[model samples]
Every structure is written in structure tokens, then in C-alpha cells.
Target: MLVSIRVAAEELGVRPETLRRWESQGKIEAPERTPGGKRRYDLAKLRHLAPHKAPSERVTILYARVSTNGQRDDLVRQRALLETFSSANGWPYEVIEDVGSGLNYHKRGLKQLIAQICSGRVGRLVLSHKDRLLRFGSELVFSLCEHFGVEVVIINASENSTFEEDLASDVIEIVTVFSARLYGSRSHKNKQVMDRLREVAKEVSP
Candidate 1:
């Protein structure tokens, strides 16, 4: 069914003049004309037009990550590169950074970005490299992007030392967690000794 220009514009949260202007600019198809030559918008067409955000209007996400705190400088560099890349593409974007293992899914920033992607607010995802997004399951995210009509751009698709670094970091993290657990368990009988042992484990963690 069709609605009058005024009603359609109100429902779409735009002024009637704005809709008319967009129609004249060919940004959207013209609404159907009434017998009296007044414009009326089809509900289906109006809804479809609502999501057609222009490149500048769309939300772009620049995601960057490093495997450890020792690589904070690398995180800064990655954010800078993402900012430059997004600027060159002529779109404003939010930079999301994570300082944790790529193989881990519990990063706060990563979860927030994924929520935005699934919510349909994200129009594009820009990454310096694919592995920068994840170590193994990055394709699952890319598939989600494809399903949501979000474009994925990789500035440097070439594999670098990042993959190996993440592997090493993951190994260290796994070992540390197990060592901590083992130490605590074996020393449960001696509370004072267990506390000191955990402290030493923390000092040795890299």
C-alpha cells in the first residue's frame, strides 16, 4: 500500500521535502504519483530505501590487535595505519583495538565489533591484515560480513611475523595457566607457600 508524501516522510523520519529532494537527485526512485499527480510512497519501497546509506553515512570499523602487552607500540602503529587507510577511502570509522591472543574470543573490543556487525550498523570492516582480525577463525567473521552486506578490506593481505608471534604467545599463555593451576593445587596444603609460588609464576610470565 502507498502513503501520502507527508505521512511516508514522517514514518521514515525524514521531512517530505527531503524525500522529494532525494527523489529528484535520483538517490532514490521516485514515489508513485497519485491520479492528481501528488507523490505517494510504497511501504516496501520506503523500507528498502531506508538502509541505503551512502559511503560517508555508513559506519566503518577499523579493527586492530596484537597478541601481548609488550606489543603496545605495534598496536599504536596499527591504529595509525588503519586511520590513514580509512581516510584514504574517504570514510569516517571507529578504531577497535585488542591486546590479547588472536586465538582467544574473549577480547572486549572484538566482542563489541562483532555485536555491531550483527546489529546491521556496520557497513564495512577494514583490517591491516586478515590475521590481525583473528588467528584461525577469521573466515567465520568474513562470512558473517558477507551475509550482512558489509564489505571487508585488507590493506596488507600478505602474511607476516604476526602469525608466528601469535602462536608463540598462545603457547606461553596456555603454559602459564596450567602452571598456575598446578602450583596452586599441589600447594593447597600450605597456604603461605602457595601464595609465594603464584607470585613467582606471575613474575616469570611473558
Candidate 2:
């Protein structure tokens, strides 16, 4: 699908002006111009800016995340499906697995995959669904992929509904933030209790 500069900017979390500047600087290639001189970005161009690499001689990377231990079998199935997809397409593939909450991509395997993408080791990233790869906001991840000239393929039906994904991400962010706060408060209380016990022991000794 073709998108206007404004829509592309919104999807990419960048100012339209910045995209223009990047085009001018040759950091990013300029999109095709319409008869009316409006810029139009194709899926190819947008994927070129993905956090992963464009399909080249390099192998594609498949990232699979299972939210819990019980989903380990699901993770394997995902990997198998990706391998089959790659084989059917005649593409080389590498698989990365993370057994953690999809709420974040900071897991060790995911981090390694990102490192490879940033280093230009992988040509493309394939995920079963946006939510499978992004329980958090995909904007940052997409931006990173784009900056590195990577390509991404979401194998699900919803393609790329940035608005819906953003809403879901906001909810996940709130939960994560609150969970962290609660953990911090509990830690603080535990520290205080330990401190009081130390003081009591010292007073009794004196």
C-alpha cells in the first residue's frame, strides 16, 4: 500500500519535515512523487526502514515470544512455522526464541536479535503477529528497524493498524508502570523493616 508523507510520518513517529530532511540528506531515499508533487511511500520503502534488514544475501530472522512457560510448545510451533515459511519462499532463516511476557522485548534472545538487526547481520524480521512481537508500542521498534534499513513482515491479518496497536500498548505501559511502582514500594518496606530490626538488636546489645 502507498502512504502519504504525513501518514508515513505519523506511522513512523517522525515529523514530516524530518523525513523530508532525511530525504534531502540522502539518509533515506525520497519516495515517488505524484503528478501533483505529493510524496508517496510504498510498502517496499517503508519496510526498507524497518528495524531489521532488507531481504538480501543475509538470512532472515524470525523472532518468537511465548508469554509463559506453558507456551513453550507454542514457541516451538512458531519456530517450525517460520522455518516452513522460509523454506517455501526459498529464503534462509534464523530463529530467536524468548520465553517471557510479550509485554517487553528486553529478554535476552530478543535483545540478541535486535543487536543482529542493528549490526546488519539479518536481512528481515518475520513475526506471526504484531502482538506476538510487540506487547509494547511497536513505534520504537519500528523506528529502530527503519533506521537500520531493515524489513519487517507481520504474518497476521491486521497488517499495521498503528492506532489500535498504540492503544493496546498504552494499556500495557500503564500496567507495567504500576507493577514496577508496587515492587519498588514493597522493596522499600522490606528495607525499612530490616533497618528497624538492626536498630533493635543494637539497642539490646547496649
Candidate 3:
């Protein structure tokens, strides 16, 4: 069926100007023109432009996360920041919020995000910070996204939080868990281990 330039751009996930440029560069066949000089596109021919899915059908996802409920305010701020950033870019988007340790891979939001990506339902994944996705193995998820043709956008390329800070935090959480498991949650040895880890963390963290 014949469609207008605007509709073609929407279906192809590009601007009408991009279509014009492609035509000029001989990248795509020229569009039909009405007597009034309006460009008309044939949807049948343009399906090749978006081989995976119609770009309009794949949503832009803004993901936000915090390590704990204590950081609920930070999670809220992350959501707001992501919303503002995507809105500024004129992206049609949805925000997914998660509250869990970055070491946790079983977070509901994270699972949902991965599921959507695998299903080819997501066009883009936007994050306020890379660590917000996962402290460890985030690269694996990124690889999955790349395989699925999902674009990953990190809002802040350079982290405001240092690796040492994150490492210390992760160490403390790990020690807390293992100490409890080995020495029992209420055991004095567990307390001592946690205390010692805190002291070492303080020494190493900036």
C-alpha cells in the first residue's frame, strides 16, 4: 500500500529527511510523487529497511535500579532522570525500576528486561549508569543485546562512582552474607568478621 513520507519514516525508524538522503545517495529507490509534489512510499518495498521488526513496534526501555530499599529515593531520582533524558531525545519509552543488589541477577525488572530483549521487542536499552544494571556480568547482558540488535545507551559514559567504591561495597555485602552462613547470623564470630571487613573497607574506600 502507498504511504506518505512521514508514515514511511515512522515505519523505518528514521526521519523523512533520512529517506530523502537515501534516495539521493541511491541507497533506496526513489519514492513516487503526487501531482502536488508529495512523496509517497510503498510499505511492501520498505519492509527491507527494517529487517528485524518495524522500528515503531520495538519500544525504547529506560531502566533504573538501586541496591536496596534504603536507596528508594535514589531509584526514584534515577527514574526521573531517565524519563527526562529520553523525553529530551524525543524517544517513545517506558521506565523499568528495580530494587535489589547489583550482584543479584534474579531481579524482576532485570528478568523482564532480558526477556523483552530476547523476544526482539526492545529497540533500545537506556541506563543512567552501567552498574545500575548489574555490578557483575553486565557485559554478558550487553552481548545478548548486541546479538539481538538492541542498542545500548549508557547515559553517563564515565562513571561518577569509582570502581574501588563499588568493589568495597560489593565486598562488604559478600562478607556479610558468607559470614552469616559460616558463623551463623547471631554468632559473635559473624559480628567480628563483619566488623573487620568494615574496617578494611574504610581503609580502602575513598
Candidate 4:
């Protein structure tokens, strides 16, 4: 996909002039020019900024997550599928699994993933589905990955939710977060609230 310099800079959390400077400094690939002489960047190439570390030292990561302990079987299956995919591609990969709510950003697995990415030890990230990373704000992680020149691969990109489904998800996420905050995560009251909300969510969903 092609995007204007402003869009690319915004995604990277950098100023537009920084992109122009990087282009001039050979830090990034030169962008395509429009008929009116405006610059357009290839989104894919823009993601692969020059890495700070040697390629051989970086590892590909296969990450999976499930909302609760009840989904252990699903998590295992996700791990196995990711391993098979990486093996087929002959990539040296490691698997990171999390049993937590997607709305929670403080997951240990997620923290470790961010640390590795910041340390320049991640060459790529592979996911079975996009939301497997987070219920929301997955793009922030992707932006960090892009800033560090880590390639992102999503095996199932067609699993997008309809508007109604998304609304259901958002409702559930809000309930889950606020219930935990109001009643404490392990409190019986929170459990009761979640149980009722889940039913309501199902009713509203397709």
C-alpha cells in the first residue's frame, strides 16, 4: 500500500520532516513521486527501517494468547499451528503464549515481547490472528515493531469482524475491564458481572 509522507510519519510517531531527512540520509528507501511531485511511501518497505542489530542475532517470534485458563486447549492448538508455519518457512522461531484478557496490556508475555523488540532481538512477529495480540491497540505494538524493523506476518488476515460483532466485542471488553476495576478481578462479584455480561454479549452478537 502507498501512503502519503504525512501518514507514514504519523504511523511511525515521527515528524514529516524526519521522513524527508531519513530519505535524504539514506536511512530509508527513496519513496515514489506522484505526477505533482508529491512523495508517496510504500507502506511495506517503510516498515522495514534499517535494523540496529545484525540480522543473524535476531529471532522470529510466534505469539499466541487466550482470554482465560478455560481456553488452554485453544492456546495449545494456536502454538502448534504457529510452530508448523514457522517450520515450513525454515525460520528460527520461539513461541510466547499468554493466558489473559486481550484488554490487559500488562501481560508478562506481551511485556517480554516488547522488551525483545526494543532490544533489537526480534526479526519478525507471527500471529494466527490479529486480535490474538490484543483486543485493541495492537497497532501500537505493530508501530513499535515497524520502528525496530521487525516484519509482521498474520496468517489469517480474513478473520475481520462485522460491525455488530465488533460492537459486541467492545461491550464485552468494557464490561470485563470495568468489572475487574470495580469489584477486583478475583472477587466473586466480578465473576457474576462477567457471567451476565457474556450472556448479554452473545445475545447482541451475530
Best by lDDT: 4
Shift of residue 53 alpha carbon in model 1, Å: 9.7
Q: List the residue pairs that clash in candidate 1.
A: none
lDDT per residue (tens digit) for residues 113-186 in model 1: 89998888888899998888876689888767755656677888655555456555445555544555566666
- Mind sharing the TM-score for model 2? 0.56
**Candidates in order: C-alpha RMSD to true structure:** 14.4, 11.7, 9.5, 6.4
The Cα local distance difference test for each model comes to 0.74, 0.69, 0.81, 0.83
lDDT of 4 by residue, 1-206 (tens): 99998778655645466689888999888999999999999978866643322365579999999987888999999999999999998989998999888999999999999999899888889999999999899989987876786767788877887899888987877786676676755788768877798789979988
Candidate 3 lDDT over 35-122, as tens digits, reads: 9999999989987877533355689999999876888999888999999999999889988899877777999999999999899889
Q: What TM-score would you give candidate 4 relative to the actual structure?
A: 0.70
Q: Is candidate 3 or 4 superior in TM-score?
A: 4
Deviation from native of the Cα of residue 135 in model 2, angstroms:
0.5
- Compared with the true structure, what per-residue lDDT tens digits does model 2 show for residues 91-170? 78888888766666578987898789788766677888777776766667766766765666667736665665456544
Clashes of each: 0, 8, 0, 0
TM-score of each: 0.56, 0.56, 0.68, 0.70
Runs in model 4 lying further than 4 Å from the true structure: 1-57, 180-194
lDDT of predicted model 3: 0.81
Give Cα distance to truth, residue 59, candidate 3, Å: 0.7
